[model samples]
Target chain A: MIRTAVIVFPGSNCDRDMKVAMEAVTGSPVAMVWHGDAEVPACDVMVLPGGFSYGDYLRCGAMAAKSPIMRDVIAKAKAGTPLLGVCNGFQVLLETGLLPGALMRNASLKFICRDVHMTCDNNETFFTNCYRKGEVVTIPIAHHDGNYFASDDDVARLEGDGRVVFRYSDAVGNATPEANPNGSVANIAGISDATGRIVGMMPHPERLFEKALGGTDGRRVFESALFSVTEATT
Target chain B: MKAHIKITLKPGVLDPQGKAIEHALGSLGFNGVDEVRQGKFIEVELAEMDEASARAAVEQMCEKLLANTVIENYAYELVA
Candidate 1:
């Protein structure tokens, strides 16, 4: 069985939703680990869900990054365990130094809540195995600090290494600057680390895992990631 | 002695609360408002004997909690 754990912080609002998505797609129970807990439950995948953790005080994910459970998450990521973070969770990953760059406030200085289009820039990554290269997918994003920013050199490094897993795209899969909601660098909406085991994005894929909830494409991400895990274990 | 650390977002970054204040000021007939930005001022006290220790302690505070190096920046002043 592919063990999964959804991390829950004090102010996390999407832990259950992420657990549900993992269960529905993986057909297995996902352990809900508390932030105060020092150890993460034994799981092959660790998910950091979205919410206003610590009321986003002192910066969105600053306080949560120092949580006890994050130490385990960081250790796991270093050991090549698959780690995924979404929305404020993404901010946590960056704050933990698991990923690069910071998620700044939206340029418009408003909370953006809408469906955004994304294109797969690299399909070979463990998290994106189910999506085709250049394929377009729409996921919902709701955040005040979703604007992704990195130094110009960092952007070049991500692009040169093909670490940018997804970019904001139009309906036709063409990257459109106008369609970008948060003014992220290079229209990037999602990215993986050098090893591809750590993936973080500002969009809430768990919220769109079901067609009834306005999406089904998001499920492919979990499915693909599970496939990678199952293949690795066998 | 106590120290006050003021943390502020960078210039290019957006500050909604600050913008709101600027708007309110403009509405109240305050003119020549070119820009407005918001920041946090945190007061911390230390009983160390030396200035070097005080500086080191404040730097530690900035890295460990007071400021998030990722997005926000911070500056400190000593009040004796």
Candidate 2:
């Protein structure tokens, strides 16, 4: 069985959704790790669910990035534990420097909450293996700070290394610059580190997992993590 | 001695609160405002100490608590 843990901070509204997604895929209940806890339980995969941590004070994910558990999260990520961050969790990952760049507020200066299309950019990442390159999926995005930005050089580097895992796309699955919701440099919706162990994305794949809930695109994320550890041993 | 710390979103990081403020200013008859950005200000009182220690403490505060370095920047100066 693939062991997993979901790290929950105060105000995390999507922890349960992520837990359900993981449970549906792994056939097990994931341990819920708290922000104040100094340790994380042993697990093959770790997920940081989304919400307005610390009331989005100082900045989105700013305070949560410094929470005690994050130190362990960072250490675990460095040790090659598969970690996934979504929405506010993505903000936390960036703030902790686990992933590069930052997720800023939308360009329109309004809280964007609705479904958006995304294109698969990386087929090799642990969080992307289930999707073929260029595959399009519709996932919901509900965030104020969803704009992804990095230095010009950083953008170039990410594109060069194929670190960008997903990009915003039109309803037809075409990645058009006009479909960008937050003025992200390259319409990027998700990215992974050079090692591919850590992944962060702005869209809420967890929210779209069940067919009854509207879609099953989220199954891909959990499936990729399963492939993560299994592929290593095989 | 007292120190004031200002933490701001780094350049190019979107500032929604700042944008709202800018919008409010425009509605209130202020014009020609190119942009608006929001930041945080914190006041800290410290015992008489060397400048080096004060700077170090402030930096520690940023790294551990005050600012999220990946998204925001912070600067502090002692007063009195």
Candidate 3:
């Protein structure tokens, strides 16, 4: 069984959702880790769920990134544990310097909450192995600061390194300007680190992991992580 | 001692909030505004008596938490 841990911030609304998804996919009990806790339990995967941490004070994820739990989380991630960050969680990853780039306010200057189509840009990564490159999937994004930004050099390096895991795209898989819901640079919806073990994305896979919730498109993400861990263990 | 800090988005970064404010100003009959950019101002009360130490601490704070250097630039002045 794949052991999973979900880091719960003070304002995290999606922690339960992530726990439910992991349990459903991995058939294992998921650990709920408080942000104030100093140590993280041993687990195959760690997730930072979506929410307005620290009430979005100072900046999104800025305060939360400095929480006590993050010190260990950052260390574990650097030590090569699989880490996934979604929505505000992504912001935390950026603030922690685990992921390159910053999530600026939406170019439209509005909180966008809706389903968006994204094409899987890299299927070789542990987080994306369940997806086929160029496959378009529907996922919901709800945030005000989901516009990903990096310096020109950093953006170029990310593209060159095949770290861009998902790009906002149309139903037919064309990454057009109109298809970009948050005006993210290069229509990016998700990216991975150099190791491909850490991923930060603006969409909520936990929100749509089950068919009863709406669609099963998001299940593959969890399944992908489970598969990667299982393969490593076996 | 007090430290006054200003954080602004680096040039070339899209500032939709600032742009919206500019547009609102134009609609309100304010004309000839070339552009508008937005930033944040923060004041910190420091207990450090030494100016050099205070400056270093504030710089560290800005680099670590007060500002995200990825897309923002920070400037500060110390008032003793």
Candidate 4:
């Protein structure tokens, strides 16, 4: 069985939703690890769900990044535990230094909540193994500070290293200015760590994991990642 | 001891909030506002007595938490 745990911080409105998504697909009980804890239970995959952690005060993810549980998350992340951060969770990853770059306010200076197309840039990572290269998928994004920014040189390095896993794209999978919803640098919508064990993105893949949710495109991400975790044990 | 910290976005970074503030000022009839870059100012009171020591402590805080070096820079002054 693929063990799963979801980290829950204060004001994490989506923690239950993330748990529902993981359990629905994985058929495994997911633990809700509180931010006050020092460590998460043993699990194959750990998810950092979206929400206003610590009310997003002191900079979106700043305060939460200093939480006690995050200290353990950071240590294990370095030891190679698979982690997936979604939306505000992505902000936490950046603040924890587990991922590169920073998320600033959207160029339009507004909170955007809508479905956007994303092209799978690299399918070799654990989280995206089921995706075909360059395939376009629909996912929902809702955030005020989703604009991804990094130094030009750092952007180049990420591209060169193939850590970039997804890019905002049009319906036809073409990366265009109009298709970029958040003005992220290089149209990057998602990326993985150099080890490919950690993935962070602003979109809520767990939000559309079922047909009733209007799209099943997001199911494969959870399924693909869980499969890898289960496969590793056997 | 009181420490004043100013946090600003690094050069060349896009500041949408600052831009929005600038536009709002323009609409309110504030002229000659070529640009307006918004930042944060923080005043911290510490029990430390030495001015130099307090400034150094606050500077460390800036580097560690008050600022995100990836996109922002921080400057601090210690007041007696």
After superposition, the stretches of candidate 2 with alpha carbons farther than 4 Å from their true spots are: B10-20, B69-71
Q: What is residue A56's positional error in candidate 4, in angstroms?
A: 1.0
Instruction: Report chain B TM per candidate.
Output: 0.91, 0.92, 0.94, 0.90
Best model per DockQ:
3
TM-score of structure candidate 3? 0.99
lDDT of 1 by residue, A1-234 (tens): 789988899899988899999899999889999999999877889999999899998888999999888988899889988999988889999888888888877877889998989998898887889999999999898999888987777889999999999898899888888878888888889889998889998888888999889888788879987999999989
lDDT of 1 by residue, B1-80 (tens): 78889998876656667888899899999998857888888998889548878888998989887787755788998889
Model 4 stretches astray by more than 4 angstroms: none
Q: Candidate 3 — which pairs collide?
A: none
Residue A9's C-alpha lDDT in candidate 1?
Answer: 93
Q: How well is candidate 4 docked (DockQ)?
A: 0.82
Q: lDDT tens string, model 3, A87-184?
A: 99999999999999999999988899998899999887777899988999999999999999998898999999999999999999999999998889
Using Cα atoms, each model's DockQ against the true complex is: 0.48, 0.55, 0.96, 0.82
Error of 1 at A93 (Å): 0.6
A85-146: candidate 4 lDDT, tens digit per residue: 99999999999889999999999978999999999998988788989999999999999999
Docking level for model 4: high
**Model 1, residue B66: what's the lDDT?**
75
Docking class of 1: acceptable
- A best-first ranking of the candidates according to their DockQ comes to 3, 4, 2, 1
Better of 1 and 2 by lDDT: 2
Candidate 1 at A228: error in angstroms?
A: 0.9
